[model samples]
Target: MNSELKTDRVFLEIFKNRVQAIVEEMANVVLRTGFTAFVKETGDFGTYLLSPQGETFGCPLDTGYNLSLGIPAGDVISSIGQWNEGDIVICNDPYSTGGMATHLPDVYLLKPFFYEGQIIAFGLCFIHSSDVGGKVPGSVSPSSYDIYQEGLRLAPVKLYEAGVLNEAILRIFLDNCRIPDQNWGDLRALMAALNRGERRLQELVERYGISRVESGIEDVLVYAETRVRQMIEDIPDGEYEFWDYIEKGPGGYPVRLRCKMVVRGDGIFLDFKGTDPQVRASFNIPTLNKQGHYYLVPALIRYFRTLDPSIPWNSGMVRMITNDAPSGTLLNPEAPAAIGARAATFIRLMDVLTGTLSQAQENKLPAAGAGQAAIVMLAMTDPVTGGRKVGVVQPICGGSGARPMKDGIDGMDFAVGHLRNIPAETVEADMPILIERYGLLPDSAGAGTYRGGCGIDLQLKVLSPDTVLTARNMERMEFQPWGRLGGKAGAYGTAVKNLGQPSEERTGRIDELLLQPGDTVSFFSQGGGGYGSPYKRSPQAVARDVRNGLVSKDAAYEQYGVVFHESKVDLDATQKRRSAVYGSTDEQQSFHFGSAREQFESIWSDEMQLAIGAALTVYPLALRDYLKRCAMKEIDDRFHRGEQVQAIEVAEIMAAIHRTIAAL
Candidate 1:
């Protein structure tokens, strides 16, 4: 181990805050000068200061999104061959940079900071562009089959060489994308943010001397690692495994995700060995087989924060943890696999991690929330100019799961850094749509002593003819978010059009829809899972929820065993009703996955998933996706066709799969 630096605790704390302030300043610059609605309104951007080794040393906690916190740029930097003082490297390729940029729409820029003719640090910035020239207007579609169909994929290339702009590369972006001016403006803002961070880093070096500044950074990282390791050691050493499924895949098929966590001493290992193979749709996460920890780091930081609020936020926090996912699985897809909609799978993975840990430490973890971001994008023709106007209507999200000590937050999804919803006025001004209704869904939260958060209900009326719509990350439609310790499961959400009319249409998670003028579209997000038993809730709390329009009177009485008479809770009657309903004490289970998941898992059990995964391992890597798809199709066909399938039938199917594998 390296010798401990002479820096004191006071100096280290001060320097940590100073570095965070610099990154915050960098984010402010980008937000103030950015061009697209996604960047300014939705805040889809990130800023960070990276060490010479490309590990993130500092990131803004108050201003930018946390999705890019674990993006590693070491490979991207090294792939560029060499760098100069004014050079800026740009990349969006997931495979080349070890999954630094998960999708093509997120454009990343990196710049090196130099002091005394030696590179001291790097400034990194990324933003989700509105358009990058793809098969769809928004540059992302759930139906896209490959990366080539998603958008232009840029490998690590020099956007600026020795302070000289590369006009050729700039022209290529302008000529190919639908919104050239907006792309150019966002790119310039990213460059400005990088420059701002680089200048601030140099100033820090000048004030504290290069040696002291570098040592301070190293000390901060070591401090973070030590704190996290100590926290890991506290948890009882054992192996905890969990399995969950995605309700819909590329062709409306179900995809399964399994996780096994082994905590031994100060080290933790996360293995995704029995996860389903990569899908044909855009839901695959290109984690580059186990090298990328982008999907695992965010939840770990959140977990560690509960233990030690002062733990430094940097790449070093993950040093004591290791991640492993088999190649060609949903977490680590091969080349050309569409990944534009990978966030759908990524958030579910977060739940898998949370669920696995909750098994060991139920008191420390909350239940599952609305596990995905329901982003609605609309493309319509301008009435006056007859030109296409494409923009995000709203990134609708749902509530958080209930905590041990408190209720979950209503109408907010905390998994994705608490992204704010776009105001209704902003949507009307940008697109030809009117926001009719936007509020919470009544009785949507899971029922428990401390209730889970409620989901949202949004209604939009189209004012333009032939308006096209694309919605991504729509999940929890079939299997409701699971609850813990006897808490009831939350309600699922849906998408429908032309409500209360003869031509009214209802659809499952859709890729695109053409709507005529005056047609209405509605989106209802899923609620979070509750934490504890519902019978233990106070009658006053249930009455308050009913009065506030968050819970229905009937549901409150039925689910919570609360008695209400004419808008008032009868304390004597409530106690008698609770006793009659629950009979002494409420029966509790480790997990309550609701009836939908229970029915689905009855046929597709954990043993069946493992057997299929093991059979595929015998085939060539290139053929695994195909074999897995065929096997899943057979299973889904029996259920979808309304055929009664028993355990014996499923066993026979597994036997047939093994036979096929042996023949191959």
Candidate 2:
């Protein structure tokens, strides 16, 4: 492979860039024709052109999440039957199509790029539409219990037949959605993006010859594969396990997720067999097959490349990987399971992977970061305009975890990259809400030798009578972003209504409460965890943070063992505090995390969750909710009766009880 790369360095570089250009053109088409403000303004869609063999060669360089296109597009092409000219297949079946479409509202369209009646490649596009028919205004919510409730599931249906749009299918979709025009327009834009990819591929074939272009695709994969292997080989191989939590799902129970990976030589296997079984709520991952693993591979690869930058990002990097998730786990759900907002699970997956890799090579990885991205889509029915208004109040994100030598980036992009926050001015112009404030939260950042970057705070006042806040991927409330080594944990996130006026803070629920005039909503995002001991942090850094208004002078003196005098940090006083608080290296005592939450977490391990999930599966979500409450009461009674916590050895039963307690 290296010899091949050496011989074709010039050719590979040119071919790679050319394929990238094709994807860029595809994205441009989508942006030009897209109707919704989310897609046009924020550019939340993706396009890719793959080889007939199901390898992503070229993808959109800007806009949308490109990594999303790689694995799902490959899975879709492989699932279909013999292809022909003008065959466009549509699929939003999260289970059948893998993590391609995490939920129903994300529509995925794929068309075979054919030449001379021979299918040579495929063009694919996906968009998060304004709506799909569901119990809620939008198709997603943490609490939704079934896919049917989430929205319509199109299982590889033909959106276009013999080069013509399927009007009947279009009508069905339009009738089911609240915003028909926006949905139709987004669908058309996706189609246009697909056509652009097809045209670009055809042009490449015309210029470079069909066979050469095909070879180019294969060559890109081969080249990428070799580079990835070399990169893996550079790292010392070993088995590593890491666990992270999604504070709570719609069911109000914290979801415990674990990842046990074996990195051997140039290959890796992610074993999720011990993971918690599928939940009754929409938090379940709908992908039935191993394809859901694709969602995690890009993130793992990205993390790996951060250590070794020479690795190429084409399909080859992860070709040697295998995912062994149990059938009923959240990572691989069974039939009839609801999976409306599976992105939350995916975020957990990324976090676990990051943690595992970090454990394997501490110096090569960053500390645990603000893993979950806060995605809130605010929609309102304006009585004055008589039209639906939608806006993104904030694309909330937390600070990145700190590194060995450097502090983590604040409000960074996690999982899929390049997702930009919508400007406050745009939200006001397009929607009925007025954005009161949008800025970084002072002192919300994780404090350590290298402090984690801070997350953002957003305050919005409702202007209309009815405003629906459809929030997804908001986590780290119960379990703050964890730190590594000797670092401190970051602050938890919260959402409150009627701020400072009989307000209630909500951690894991979405509601459509009527908004009276002067009602305000305040949102605070989670902070990323620090990397090392706060006392070890440079005094100058703390002084800078104080001077910049990021850390309060009092906080610097107390939490961070730094001192300030007359609005300025006193270097000698800070040094004295640091030495007194932390002591000398030899005399310093190791920080101990006691049993404050240990016993609580013991009952919520992966093994126990499966038993609880099994019982819940036998009943519908509503009945399960009642049973869960009873189980928690029983546990509380037992606890009060002087029962030893260790005696509760029934993992599943214990987990079930813990789930209920956490929910309550």
Candidate 3:
């Protein structure tokens, strides 16, 4: 309760924006100095200022990954021994720093800003490393079952001690990584950004005075907390429950994510009690069970910003909200769990959060969109130097869900959308690869009054031998994005090997694929779900989509009942078709999850899944993944034989697996 900040309203607003501008300027410094394509070209980096206590108070508006707006910095701050005048602490271990890094590739650094022999604030910055020491070239693979296999796990330590270089630690890190020189360049870029932020912060303290600057930092937290509470109070106090998944269910469990959001007055409680157990894949999110973790409540944060439009980026926004994502779940796994592909799970968690909150608000949020992204990278050996080289081909971006009044963003989802698309020429220059096709997927979006966004279609050919193609965060292939309010479901993701060739084959999600010279491959991202009924859409709008090559005439006729004759809609025939298909439509349903998911949900009812999910958890962590797959195989056999399963019979199936497998 600083009286200076409490009374001076205009000064507080200026202080907030000034802090943001400093960080924004810090972003430019990193882009100018960063070496890797991920840093300079893709812009997979961020710079911000934190309170002395390590709460993020300022973040850039439109740079880097906005998905990490409320990222926690306190754990990294507390882990280090002490803060000196010119020391920079860095770490990438998710387990040691209380899930501050989440994955190894994302290296985070924190620097304390001091003035007059006292700590004023902290400078925080992070950049995604092209590669750290790991099994794969990119240091990311779905097959990685533990953190050790992912990359070099660094605990919080003094990367820059008293403004002097720590060559001993630097040499060890460089020796472990793939491209030592480029990685070191990126590290220097981060240090430069931190130093730039520190300079601006010193100027801020000089202009505003030490007492006022300190008061402003403390006041922003109180302001953000009060504003968030006011917004949460608007919703009626009730418990709303919703669930979603990552498609790879163990037996029937898949990686199901369930949330029970309880809104009571100004405080919101998120209980993730029914989420599926951690899997063997690199999909776990090590959140350390922190209250209102950034992973658990990203959607809610987006909602708050939408409502207020100027909410402060700090820890106080989460002060009124509490979370209970139980230990052992993917959201809060134990130590050493693989988290290379945790971004995929983080995207799905947003879906579950949006679904839960949509129940409380009437048409507040749009239906789910292509809620995933895959980073396509090509790895090869440089012929001249025989050195390892990896280049990001492109980001497989997806469309957003259709909104109530507007269509979703086509071919670029807001989730991790800040990662820019690399140019075709740049891809060619960096690696021996040829771009065959790169554009939006036609007829991929859901059919609704307001159509969902379209996904990407990228195909490339390798020009060199012994090339490895890796794509991470591939999802939504098994379970397509579901639509709400009588809207139809969107298209599912597709991956193919040698598409349209004599050796054509449909590949699902690719962990890793080695390519030969002249071999071509294709990757298609999923489109977003639509909002409202397709039949109610304007025929002209459907015709526009057809003309733009985003929708075919046949789909326009069948899905939207829009009769297009010679590229022109025949309104009379369209009206008749709509009237004829009225009775059998999805008008009565609140959510249209498409035929595939609908049938899957019908076959594996919630009762059966809950029973099976619980049964699988009883086994040891190492044994559950294997047992679940075996149990699912047995269940699949029963399905093929036309046998129906009840919840009561689940125990018998579990007992059989336990006896046959556990006994051995």
Candidate 4:
């Protein structure tokens, strides 16, 4: 056959299916043979096939952990320098891998697929291991100040060389981790999956000539790029800017993220110029300035997929997009900036990108969601061995935002959709904990024509002493989820210990807490923001929601102005109430941020944020972190002390910051 025929559309699609099947089989092998609760029960693992140059060619699509499908392996490939048959390499250092592995707990393994004494492709897989040896038992904490405290940082190194297992490296890993046996078993499962992928890939190369297989990879990527560029061209060309903030960081300070997107013809540019400098906490996201990373591509990909699912999932999807996240900022933090809780920042970044695109595309996007992952980890002493055991009790997620024509999904967030929560039965059997109650929170969703989804409420009791609970990405406690197009904002999240008793303590965000037996911990995730005006909603729909216990009678009347008597909608009364509650249609506000955020933004306006970013740009990178803290502290102190500052006073603070940068 001619070269043209080998790279034809039909042949390229056939090869793509073959490669995808190989990765799916690899994932199945890991799922069945893995030894940890993360892999076996939660399915927190991913498998992919890569080209020799380290671009992802194929990955499973129907699985929950599809989040890792677009991760690039080029850094690991380049670090190895050379590849041989039957050799395998491993690494989990986010900095060394250009943020490919994300955090140190995610252990990655790669093996080269050889054909006729030459490397044709590579097989790759990663799993969130049980432990990697760090200051915390789970090896991840939001309070961590640097990477050193996160976990064991593994540079690119050969775990197996020429079919021989590197025993020395294995010993080093086993000696450091808290659960040595669990880690060893999980690593072996990864190796087995890679071997299965290698066998399947070699078979494909033997069936179709090696040259045709190689050409098909190139054709698939080119096709994806063409499809995505066309999608970008469909969007109106203009510059759109959106900004969001994290409520609190490690030092009890809020951080802002600014995104300015420019769409011209068939390409887009994302510049995070006014985002806050990187904090000393683990909330930083290590994007490494790469556009292909999911931190930059997922939001766009999600939008495109909603338009057309036929678009191929590959690395080339990011080819039409470019990013400029200033170094030392939260998006592209410098080395040693703790990234253990990077997921918190990543979820909010997705929201900011969605918000910007919503402005540019107006009716084409949905309103903002909860915008946080809300992961909960529990560590307790093993009753049999008296050894510490750490495991994820619940990877809890909030609701998705309401769509233009439909309501948001209840009790689910897009970011953590790939990770399944551990079943209550498994949690009770494996750990010394009792799940008291778990279900959706009522009357939590924002009220609108198309109401947003509700968040979750979980209550658990500790059955063992010395249990430590660490929950990351607990946000929206101070600022509720913002609404769009005259919709009302959603409720915020909260964490409380001993709910009804006098010892009830509200811990908005838990880093680490010690509990005794019989202590109850309750957590409530934030709901999604609403879309459109609440008065536009049908009274019948409100009555149904009230009957189903999702909406209370008081909220239905107060928020939506829909009167319900004995679970029945009073049509005449509803109309009169809505007209009186909301004065006039023209006077209705388009967006509602609730009272907390509105109050905060009045003091810290968008212009002030930009001025602070510009002034910090002139300071040395080493001093930027300190200067940012000082500036925010001044504002935070006055805001908390119930003192109001005029706009002129805020501008003077900005001028003071500029003078400090110049003096240095």
| lDDT (0 to 1) per candidate | 0.83, 0.70, 0.83, 0.82
Model 3: residues with Cα > 4 Å off, grouped in runs: 1-7, 249-253, 383-386, 616-618, 639-643
Writing each residue's lDDT as its tens digit, candidate 1 over 137-199 gives 788888887889988888888889999999988787678787888888999999999888888
Q: Over 4 Å off in model 2, which ranges?
A: 2-7, 69-75, 78-82, 308-311, 502-508, 584-599, 602-637, 651-664
Query: Residue 103 in model 2: shift from native, Å?
Result: 1.1
**Candidate 2 lDDT score at position 202:** 82
State how far residue 69 of model 3 sits from its true place (Å).
Answer: 3.9
Among these predictions, the greatest TM-score belongs to 3
Cα-based TM-score, every candidate? 0.95, 0.90, 0.96, 0.94
Q: Write the per-residue lDDT of candidate 3 for residues 296-391, one digit (tens) a residue.
A: 777998888888888877667887888898778788888778999898998899888889998898588888889887888878986666767876
The TM-score obtained by model 4 is: 0.94
Q: Write model 4 residue lDDT over 134-218, tens digit each, in one string.
A: 8877787888888999878888889999999899888887898888898988988999999999898888888988999888777
Global CA lDDT computed for model 3: 0.83
Model 1 pairs in collision? none
C-alpha RMSD (angstroms) for model 2:
4.1
lDDT of 1 at 471: 85
Higher-scoring candidate on lDDT, 1 or 2: 1
